[model samples]
Target: MTKDVEMAARNGSNGAVAGEAYYPPPPAQGGDVDVDDDGKQRRTGTVWTASAHIITAVIGSGVLSLAWATAQLGWVVGPVTLMLFAAITYYTSGLLADCYRTGDAHTGKRNYTYMDAVASYLSRPQVWACGVFQYVNLVGTAIGYTITASISAAAINKANCFHKNGRAADCGVYDSMYMAVFGVVQIFFSQVPNFHDLWWLSILAAVMSFTYASIAVGLSLAQTISGPTGKATLTGTEVGVDVDSAQKIWLAFQALGDIAFAYSYSMILIEIQDTVRSPPAENKTMKKATLVGVSTTTAFYMLCGCLGYAAFGNGAKGNILTGFGFYEPYWLIDFANVCIVVHLVGAYQVFCQPIFAAVEGFAAATWPNAGFITREHRVAAGKRLGFNLNLFRLTWRTAFVIVSTLLAILMPFFNDILGFLGAIGFWPLTVYFPVEMYIRQRGIPRYTTRWVALQTLSFLCFLVSLAAAVASIEGVTESLKNYVPFKTKS
Candidate 1:
């Protein structure tokens, strides 16, 4: 695996080299293997890594919350929305395949950082701006995960303690302490070497996947028993809210961020160019991977949407797992809490890795061989700016830890956090990045005159549908007021 990875990096036709190569580390001694505390040499991630990322990305809070996404358009549009999201994920993956091909053909360097790859080859400032947007989206994603995990932990402890002794409020303190402890642990581990140390992280991630699947299965079974004939029915009241048409349009437009997420994440293609065993010399492997990954993600989304709505019927909303009573017989709530925490921790690293690399690039450029600068630089500069350069690369690991912790503290509530997350972070990063990259790489005049005209009609349609999606999310708070099983009196 290591040899294959090295070969890909060496023979890259892409215009930019892997950033890791540009700042090469000292040569490793032959026959000397670095092993983690478990005495296992870090497996350079077999196919399992790819599978894990796909499942984790596909089955995040999105799947749990997708029922809410469908409610806006109506039950009829639910499957269709799943199809659309899947199609978009696949199409956007195609664009990334093209970028990877271009990099391989042009640079002789296969792997490039997201910004470096885009800026060096695509040659557009706005295209690089997409990287910035990706960072934002990732941070939002991390925050959502943290908040949800915290809520799950709280609810589980609350239910158990309340059941044992009729004082439920004590659960609140335990939940907060659990979240704080989790945050501190995240901060500590954020300093670990190589965010991509895949051994334990991969195992932990897979365990989480099983837990999520279990929760999904439990919900599916429960719904089946509750009322085999029960189905989600959308009434005019459910769909018709007070929001204006323009506002509705604006809201759906929010989903565009999903596109940006598709693009920036597509940069994982660069990693493929670096790793992956015996990837096709004709570069067909990348195309195949993209198709497989995106298709798989879409399928997962559809399943989640279908099962989630079916399970909750009219009650599904953001973090659908919460609607299931946070602590049921199958230990669903505790399982989800731990699993999501592990999943988000891994994702947070991936998201922050690029930022760290970029900052390191900046530091290197500014202070070439100045020993003092190198020594005191990370501390003086990083501490002052709230960046953690103590970690090997400050971008993904430490930065992600810091950002997730801070945001988790700030956005303590439920759907509010997810809604703000979808609107502010996910939409911009996912939607804008690819379009910006496409225009920048192709050139605005040509893109606008030729390509834009071709894609515009389709884009506008997506835009409108997405607008409806957003309106649906907006009306969710009111819908929640009516639908929640246990309502607090004013």
Candidate 2:
């Protein structure tokens, strides 16, 4: 049985590569071996399930901010930039997928996570670098989601307060208090035993994503047609060309960063791909799933961004939902806020799983007998009842949630943080590693036209990411000047 497990891991179900030259780390610990009680393999998800997972991960609070992003760039640049990023991401996603298998389909080995792929195709130094950025991106994303969810909760509470009173009410439920409540909810769902167990949640979250996005677009279009309640003005014209060129450039670059962040799902591509059923046609399955997910998300982005800018114009808040104000259709506004909170819960988990996997894998690798790999708990009717929870797992996972919750409470600059994370992460996770690994995997010669073009793209992404990072820092600093921590404004 043990030998069979080893053989199965070595000869991945996916037939992309053909040699046993590249072997993954031990599976008994945490290297992507799904075995039953009797030690046989277990097949899990389909292409649609995978697509749902990708969609759930990709589309989150990012979509909510697109209207503002559009407002920053105006209609012409907004939609075009988004479409361009979509194309770039799709192309890079294909590159990442191709790196999943190491041998031929019949006997090829598979990379279970992003770091795994990096270690296999790239150098150890690259692996360490990738691991740091990937985990940072995931943890940072989880923190962002926590903040967004709390904001949604706060918005809902604020709306109810306004309904009870004649004006906006100080509900005493600031972002921190809401985050505390949200932390408890995340703690429960975060304990779901495995990635496979969360697919249903992902599907529901995908549905929720489409639901709120459609509502947002519908509301914006209606508002636009009826004439905007707030003063409406075009982007470039509102600021005027007479304004400081430096300030105009700063805003433009910041918008570029936001758009980049909106498409920042490359960090978790391998982790999502890892969930597919073995004999996994990773290349084909993931490609198809990426197309479906990206296409769906792109449609939503374009509609919400263009229509939202049209409705609110330069008056759009960082979150378009907030721009709806406590108006006549207050019920729909509340429902939309509720949906955002719900979707964020799922988004938090989709990213965190990779972090959990990476940490557990490291623990297992370091201490072979620590029981950190896979421990058996009680079993139910032919099924595993609960997770293989241990002191390390419980302690670290709980601490992670607590820390992220705290960060969300402390620094609630949603758009600024999103831009910062995207800027810092874009170069390494999105462009550099993927392109470099692809060159090595495909054995593309240096200085060739294809190589030069890809390299130039990577360099461009790096420069833009750096500029975005600086701009994000400035934005955060400026926001902090007005921020009164833990205080709820009436």
Best by TM-score: 2
- Most lDDT-accurate candidate: 2
Task: List TM-scores for all candidates, in order.
Answer: 0.71, 0.88
Worst 10 residues of 2 by lDDT: 14-23
After superposition on all CA atoms, what RMSD does each candidate show versus the true structure? 8.3, 5.2
Please report how far candidate 2 places residue 164 from its true position, in Å.
2.0
Question: Model 2, which residues run further than 4 Å from truth?
Answer: 1-40, 168-173, 229-237, 240-245, 278-280, 371-374, 379-388, 488-490
Per-residue CA lDDT of candidate 2, range 279-377, in tens? Answer: 556678888999999998999999988888888876677888988876558788889888888888888889888777566545544443443333333
Each model's number of backbone clashes? Answer: 25, 6
lDDT of 2: 0.76
